[model samples]
Target chain A: MLSKDFVGGLITILLGSLYLFFAFKQRVSALADTVGPAGMPKFLGILMLSLGVILCVQSVVHSLKTNAPALVEWQGEGKRFFRAFGLLCLAIVYLVLVSILGYVLAITVLLTLVALYLGAQFSGQLATIAIGGAAILWAIFVLLLDVPMPSGILL
Target chain B: MDTILTLLPDSLNFYLVLPAILGVAWGIIGGSLPGISPSITMALLLPFTYALEPSMAIVLLASTYVGAEYGGSIPAILIRTPGTNAAAASVLDGYEMNLQGKAGLALGISLYSGVIGSFVGLFFLVMLSQLLAELALAFTPPAYFALGILGLSVIVSLSDQSLVKGLIAAVLGLMIATIGTDPVSGISRFTFGVSGLLPGIQPILIMVGLFAMSELFKQASILEDLRVKTSPRIRFPEKKLRKRLILPQSIGALFGGFEGVMPGAGGTIASFMSYNEARRWSKSKDEFGKGSPEGIAAPETANNTVAGTSLIPLLSFGIPGSNSTAILLGGFLVHGLIPGPMLFARSGDVVTDLYAGLFFAAIALFFIGYAIMPVCIWLVNKPRPYLNAFILALIMSGIYSINNSLFDLSIMLVAGVIGYFMRVMKFPFLPTVLGLVLGFMIESNFRRSLLLSGDDLSIFMDDKISLMLLTFAVIFVFGSLAKRLIQVLRAGT
Candidate 1:
C-alpha cells in the first residue's frame, strides 16, 4: 500500500501541475510590468511540484530502509472521518436552506441538528437551548452589530 | 516618563478599557475550554473586530492572548487536561496538586506567575520592538521582499520533521493568494469569473476555517471525558511560597522572552523548556513533578510571558511568529492598518495604544483570572455537543458578517475541508498561514524591485538591508536543514 506521504505527494503534484497549467493560460496584459501576473504562480507551481517529488522520494527511501509499512493507523479513524463528513453534509444543507428558511429558523434547526448529530439527547431542554441560543445570536449579530442576516418569508 | 504621560490618558480611556476587559473575559472562557486554542479563540473574534475601532480591535485581540495563556491552566489544574498546547507542561504538577487537594494554591501560583511573566515580556517587547522598527525604517522594496523571504524561512524550523510537507502547504497557500486580481496588471488571474473571488479570500476567513472549523470537525469525531470533580477557590500564595516561586518564575520569564520573539518558537516550546530548566535548577528536584508549586509556576509564567513578547516581531516587521499573532495581524489588516516600521511612522498612536492595552491586559488578567474561575469551570462542565454547536453557529455568523456575502461562507467551508485534510496529513498550519499572509508582500516587492532596477536581479543583493535580510534567510534555511540531516543520520545509525 502507498504511504500517506506518497499519496499526499501525488495529490500535490497533480495540484501543482494544474496550477501551472492555469498560470500559463493566463492572458498577459499589454501593460504588464516586469514579471507579470503569472510569474509568482508559475514559480509557486514549480516549487510545489519539486517539493512533492522530494516528499515522495523521501518516503520511498524510508520505507525501503525500514522494510515495513510505516503507515499510521488511528483507531476508528474511518468512523471518525464519516462522522465529520456527516457534519459537513449537515452544514451544507443548512447553507442551502438558510436563505429560504430565514436566519432564525435556519439557525435554530442547525443548532438542534448539530447537537443531535454530536450525541445530545433529544429533549425539551435541547429545544430550549437551541431556540434560545439562536435568539441570542440573532440579537448580537443583527441588532447589536448591525449585520443584516439572511431573511425569508418565514420568521 | 514623558512617553508614559503621553500614553496614559489614551490607555485609560473607556473605549480601550472596556474592550481590554471584555476581550480578556472572553479569552478566559474560550481558553478554559479544552480543544479551543488561543488562535481559534482569537480567530472566532476576528470578524467581530471588523466593526471596532482599530486600537480597540487590536487591544481586544491582544488581551485575549494574555488571558488565554492563564486560562489554559484552569483545566490543566482541575481536570488534568491542558486547555491550550502551552498548558501541557503545567499538567505534570498542576494535576498532581489537584490530586493532593492543593488545587487552589496551584491556580494562584499559576496566575501570579503569569502576571509577572507578562510584565517581563512587556518590558522586553517595548524595548526591542522600538529598536527593530527603527532599524527597519530604511527598508526598500527589495528589503521588504527579503524580509518576506526571511519570514518564509521560519517554516523550515516550524516543520517538525517534514520540511517537504511544510513547503508544499506553504506553496498551496501562495497559490490561494494568487486566486484574485493581479496587483500590477489589474487583471484577474484565477478568479474563474466569480466576483467574490476578485478581492481574493480574506486571511481571517481562511484562519477561522482552518483553526476553528477544522478543530470542530475533529472534536465532533472524538469522545472525551469533560467532567470536573470540583471547583476550588484560588488561594494567593503566602510570603514563604512566593519567595520559593521567585526563581522558577524568573527562569520562565527568561525562556519565554527569548522564545517569543523567535519565529516559530511559541508558548508551547517556551513553557516546556522553562519546566525542564526550572526542574534542573530547583532545590526540590524530587518534588518537581509531584505537586511542586514551582513546577506550575514556571510553565504558566513562560506561556503568559509569550503572550506579550510574541507581538514584538509582528509590530516591528509585520511578521507574526505564531498562530495567535497571525490572528492579531488579521485584526490590524481589517482596520486598514498595516503593522511594520511604516506602521509606527504612519500610525504611531496605534503602536502606543497597543502598548497601553497590553499593560492594561496584564493587570486585567490578574483580576479576570480570579473573578472568572467559576464561569470557566461552569463552561468546562457543559456538554460537548451544545458547546460545539454554538461555536459552529458563531463561525458561520461571523464569516457572513464580514461581507454579508454567502460566497465568503462557501470559501470558508472549502478552506475548512482543506484544513481538515492537512490536519490528518500532519502538515504544519503555520507555514500555510505564513505563505498566505506574506505572499503578496513577497511577490509585489520582488516585482517592484526588479522593475525599479530595470529587471536586474542583483537589486536584491545591491541594497544593504535586502542583502542582510536575504543572508539571514539563507542561514535559517540551511541551519534547519543541517539540524534535520543530523537527526536523520543519527536515527539511521
Candidate 2:
C-alpha cells in the first residue's frame, strides 16, 4: 500500500501546478503593477509547489521505509474510501433534488438513505426520526427563522 | 463599569437568555461527544446566528465557547477520551480519579476549577482588552498588515509535526482567498465569471465546512459504538483539598492568561503547561498522575481560563490568536461589527455588552455543566451511529439554511471532502482557515503599502512596527527550522 502522504503530496503538487498555470495566464493591471491581482496567487502557487516537493520527498522516504506501494494502498482501503465517496455522491444527488422535491421531502429522503447506508435497522424508529427531525428543522429554519426553503411541485 | 452594569439588564431579555441557555446546553452536548471540539460546535451553529439580533448572536456563540470548556472535561474524566484537544492533559488524572472511585469529587473539582478559571480569565479579559484597544488605536495600515503576517507565523509553532504540510495547507487557503474580486484593483482574479464567486467565499461557509462537515465526513468511516456506562455523581471538595486546589487553580489562571495572550499558544498548550507547573508547586508531587485533585483542577482551570482571555487579540487587533477566536471573528463580522480598537469607539455599548455577556456565560457554564455532566454520561451510552447521523443531518441543514443557495451547499460539500482528506492525510485544518481569514488582509495590505510607496520594497523595512512584527515572523520560522536542523544533525551522530 502507498503511504497516505504520497497521495496527499501528489495531489498537492498537481493543485499547485494548476494554480500557477492560471495565475500566470491572468491579466493584471495595465500599468503592470508589482503585487497586483496576480501577485498573491502567483506567490501562493510557487509556495505550494516547493512545499509539495518537500512533502513528496518525505512521503517517498516514508513509503520506502514502510514498504507500501503507491497505487495499491489507495485500492486497499475499500470500505473507508467507498463510504466517504458514496456519502459525497449521495449529498450531490440530494442537493440536485432539493430544489425540485423541496427541502423537507428531500432531506427526509436523504436521512433515510443515510440511515440505510449506515446500516441502521429499517424500523419505524428510523421513519419517525428521519421525518420528525426533518419537520422540526424545517419549522425552525423556514417558519421561525424566516429562511426561505425551496418548495417543489409536489409540496 | 456603570455603563456595563446598566447595559447588562437590558441585554438579558428573554430573546437573549433563551438562546444563551440553548447555546450553552447544546455546546455541552456537542463538546462532551468524542469528536466534536468547541470551535466545531460553534461553526455548526454559526448559520443560526444570522437570524438573531447581533447582541444575542454574539452572546450565543461566546457562551457556547464558554460552556464547551467544561463539557470537554466530562469525557476526559469518564472514558479517557479527550473530548476537546485542550482536555487531553486532564485525561491522565481525570480518568485515574474516576478509577479511584472519587468520580464525584473529581467532577466537583473540575466544575469548581473551571468556574474559578473563568472568573480569573474574565478579570484579565476586561482589564487587558481596554489597554490593548488603546494600543491598537495607534496602528497604521502597515502595522495591521504586519500583524496579519504575524498571525500566520503561528503555523510554525502550531504545526510542530510537519511544517511543510502546514505551509501547503496555508498556501492553498491563501490561494482560495484570492478567488474573489481583488480588494485593491477592483478586478476579479479567479472567479471564472460565476456570480457566487464574485463576492468571494463566505467565511461562514468555509467555517461550516472546515469544522463541522469535514469532521462529520471523517467520522463516517471510523464511527464506533460506546458500550461503557457509569452513573457518576458530584461532591464539592473538603476544606483541605479546597485549599490544595487554590495553588493549582492560581497556577492555571496565571499560566493560562500568559499563554492565551500569545498567538499560537492555545488552550492545549496552556492546559499541559499548567498541569506541569501545578505538579512542580505541589507538596504531593508523585500523586501527579494518580488521582491527584491538582492534576484535574490545574489543566481544567487553565484550558477554561483560555476561553475568555484568548479574545484579547481578537477584540483588540482583529487578529485571531486561535481557531475558536477566529470563529468568534466570523460571528463579529456577520453582525456588521468588525473587531479592533475602533469597536470601542464605534460600538462601545456592544463591547461593554460582550463583557457583560461573557460574565453571564461564565456563570451559565457552571450551572449548565453541573446539570448536564450526568446526562452526558448517560448519553454516551447511546448508539454512536445514531448520534453521528443526527449530527450530520444538523450540519447539512445548517449549511443549506445559509442563503438557501445550492452553490453554498456545493462549497460546503467540496470543503468537507477537502477537509476529510486533509484529516486522513494528517494535514492541519486550522492553518488553512486562518490563511483564508488573513490571506486577503495580508495581500491587500502588502499591495496597498507598496502602491503608496510607489513600489518601493523598503517601505515595509522602514516602518518600525511592521519591521519588528515581520522580524518576529522571520525569527519564528527560521528558529523552528534551526531547532529541527540541530535535532537532525545530532541524530546523525
Which candidate wins on DockQ? 1
The residue pairs in collision within model 1 are none
Give candidate 2 regions above 4 Å deviation.
A29-33, A61-76, B1-19, B482-493
Question: Of all true interface contacts, what fraction is found in model 1?
Answer: 0.77
Model 1, C-alpha of B45: deviation from truth (Å): 0.3
**Model 2 chain B: which ten-residue window has the lowest total lDDT?**
B1-10
lDDT of 2 by residue, B1-493 (tens): 5554565675565666666677778778877888889999898788888888887888788778877887888888888887799999889899999998887788889988988888778778888888767755566678768878887887886676788888888887888899988888878888887988988998888877877877777666676775445777778789988998999999999988999887778899999999999999999999999999999999989988998889887888777777788888899888889787678778777777677777777777778877887678776776665566666677777777778888888998888888888877888877887798888888888888888898887888888878988998899778877877898799889
TM-score (all chains, Cα) for each model: 0.98, 0.93
Candidate 1 Cα RMSD after full superposition onto the native fold (Å):
1.4
lDDT of 1 at A121: 97
- The first chain of model 2 has a TM-score of 0.87
Please give the RMSD to the true structure for each candidate, in Å: 1.4, 2.6
Candidate 2 per-residue lDDT over residues A1-155, each given as its tens digit: 34777677888989999999999988777864577788888878888888888888998887778676676656536678678787777788788778889888888888887776766789888898789878888888888888887887676
